[model samples]
Target: MKSKLSWFSVPYVIWMAIVVVVPILIMAVYSVTTAEGALTGENFVGMGDYAGVFLRSFRLAIIATLVCLLIGYPVSYWMAKEGLRFQRVAMALIMLPMWMNFLLRTYSWMSILENHGLLNQFFQKVGIIGLYNSLTGQSIEYFTMLRTPGAVVLGMVYNYLPFMILPIYSVILKLDVSLLEAAQDLGASGAQVFRKVILPLSLPGVLSGVTMVFVPSVSTFAISRLLGGGTQMMLGDLIEQQFLGGAYNPHLGAAISMVMMVIVVVCMAVMNHFGEGEEQAVML
Candidate 1:
């Protein structure tokens, strides 16, 4: 009966093979096989694309993940403990921006950060300095804010915040209130209870949130292009350029994509290890 019912899944399985597995297989082949007039081992270059991504995208991803964790943890905790009304309001607010186009959100930051923009205007109004400072002159100092590495991080944090919050919120909502009460009853200070009990118990959510934020942020191209300009190219942008830009080198793009996949896989594995440890401790 189970075996017979499995036949119903055959279409879905074929779809997965066609859409997911086939693409991945093609990427893997492309990553190893170089462009040639004919298929040959001469085109196969080993580990170069992976090494380039590690040198470029890895640091940005690490920074973005850390920023998301720092910002998301406290917000998730507050929502979880503050009752359903507040939780609903907060979650709605977090998710509201997602309804707006992501590219529009990225571009909006440019309006505020551009040299003649709101931030500079606000500063000027407050008599901090003129908009045309000696360093920036009359020209918009997009490099200072819009095109900097900081912009990339800011864009990533903005884009991926909801991903981090939702998973962490789930973990926090399910936390055993009795454990918190027990810690308080045992003369644990508020800080001590949080550090020892709340933090440890929330590991699974934290891991899930980190994985969600890190993977997408690392692979996002629109954020980097819109916010960081040409200077702040991430691995995603590089892959995109190879595929869509005049370069038109899908082979190199695939190689870079594979590198990104490996990095995400490794980071998730490390987070999962710690998450499982916390779960086991809770069980014991």
Candidate 2:
């Protein structure tokens, strides 16, 4: 049985070597080489010129992750405490949008957030835009929501919010009911019980959700490109431009990708370190 299992694993190992390990090795080589195939350090050295882009990417990602957590945690907690049928219906509703094509979903937001889009039209009809203009003494016809940093953040939050909710919902749903009952019996107030018991226990899910949302949000190009109208460039967009766009600089692209990967790893490591302490508290 062991030998057969090992034989089965051989195919997976080969696949990883081809698709994962090989690409990483290629990227590493590209990052350290010039267009002429000569060794160079200029690729990494030039990253300093785009410090603002890196900071903007991280800021938007962090904002999106926090927004997802702020919205998802309560929703998850509510779902966990609901009846089975209700939970199923709610989950179905939550996941329904995801069934659509990712690009289509983003395109829909483009229509809604554009200057003359549905949201603006609705607000115009309702006199909100005019009212704001009147109060502020401005002549703006429509709110400039698209092609901005906020639009990119909104896109990230909309797309990745589910990733934040599902893990937290799963974790909160599986928490031991007896723990809540025991805490209540021991004269803990509702808020106290939640703070001392539920919140601490839910840290792992929060960490997982943060990772899921932040990783993609930080590296996303499609959302930034579509919604930002090329105004809000991110690390992923920078890398994509290098490899595929008119920039045509694979070495620099690889260097940017490598640095982004390292930052993500470091962030996750810090989060996991904090999570360890939270887990210890829960255990105690």
Candidate 3:
């Protein structure tokens, strides 16, 4: 009973091999080998020079991912459990921002957060800024909000929050409502039900959200550039420089890309391991 559609994926598989696998292979080869094609460990060693950049990028990304999780879980749970009509609208609203270009969203944040921007102006007009200065006994007119790691994290969170929400929402939607009802029947509190049942069952979504948010946050150049400003650099910025900066070196860029790819693989494996742990928790 072979269906005609059984082989439908062959073209996609071939396209993926050509468009994705081939370039990665070329980059991997270029990374470890010198101009003379002699393999060396120096490329890996070179990673040390940008260690601070890596640390800062990961630190901010971890914070942003956690923040998204903290904010997204409740929202997703609420929305996923809503009436079908409202849920459809809520889903649409959540996806509305994504329909716009990502760069435009980041740029909008820049305008809002900049000094004398909408945020500051609104606070001032509302007298919140004056009250803050009076309470703190400081004569400061405006506080610096833009061009910092916090700003970078904010941009990452804003851009990737949907990624965290959507996966968790879908997972929650598919969850067996009976398990929740059974836990309730056992006299478990709302939080207890979530802890012992809902959360564990939603592990797949949580893992997906973390991967979706963290990977892009760790590797993002635009958010760091437009928000963190020129003063900060993520691995993406560093890699871009290696390739396109005045001192262009394709080999170094390729090496950095390879290292970044390894890190991504490790993070994904760690996330998967957490999903397994959650499965065990559910069984218990």
Task: For each candidate in the order shown, give its overall lDDT on alpha carbons.
Answer: 0.81, 0.95, 0.89
Candidate 2 clashes between residue pairs 3 or more apart in a chain or in different chains: none
**Candidate 3: TM-score?**
0.92
Error of 3 at 142 (Å): 1.6
- Candidate 2 lands at a TM-score of 0.95
State which candidate, 1 or 2, has the greater TM-score.
Answer: 2
Instruction: Please list the residue runs of candidate 1 whose C-alpha ends up more than 4 Å from where it truly belongs after superposition.
Output: 1-11, 37-53, 130-143, 279-284
How many backbone clashes are present in model 2?
Answer: 0
Alpha-carbon RMSD, each predicted model: 3.5, 1.9, 2.5
Name the Cα RMSD for model 1: 3.5
Model 2 gets an lDDT of: 0.95
Comparing 1 with 3 on TM-score, the higher-scoring candidate is 3
lDDT of 1 by residue, 188-277 (tens): 999999998999888878887888888888787888788778777777888897899886888878877876787688878877886898
lDDT by residue for model 3 over 193-226, one digit each (tens)?
A: 9998898899988898999999999999999999
Best by lDDT: 2
Of the two candidates 2 and 3, the one with more favorable lDDT, higher being better, is 2
> Can you give the TM-score per candidate against the true fold?
0.86, 0.95, 0.92
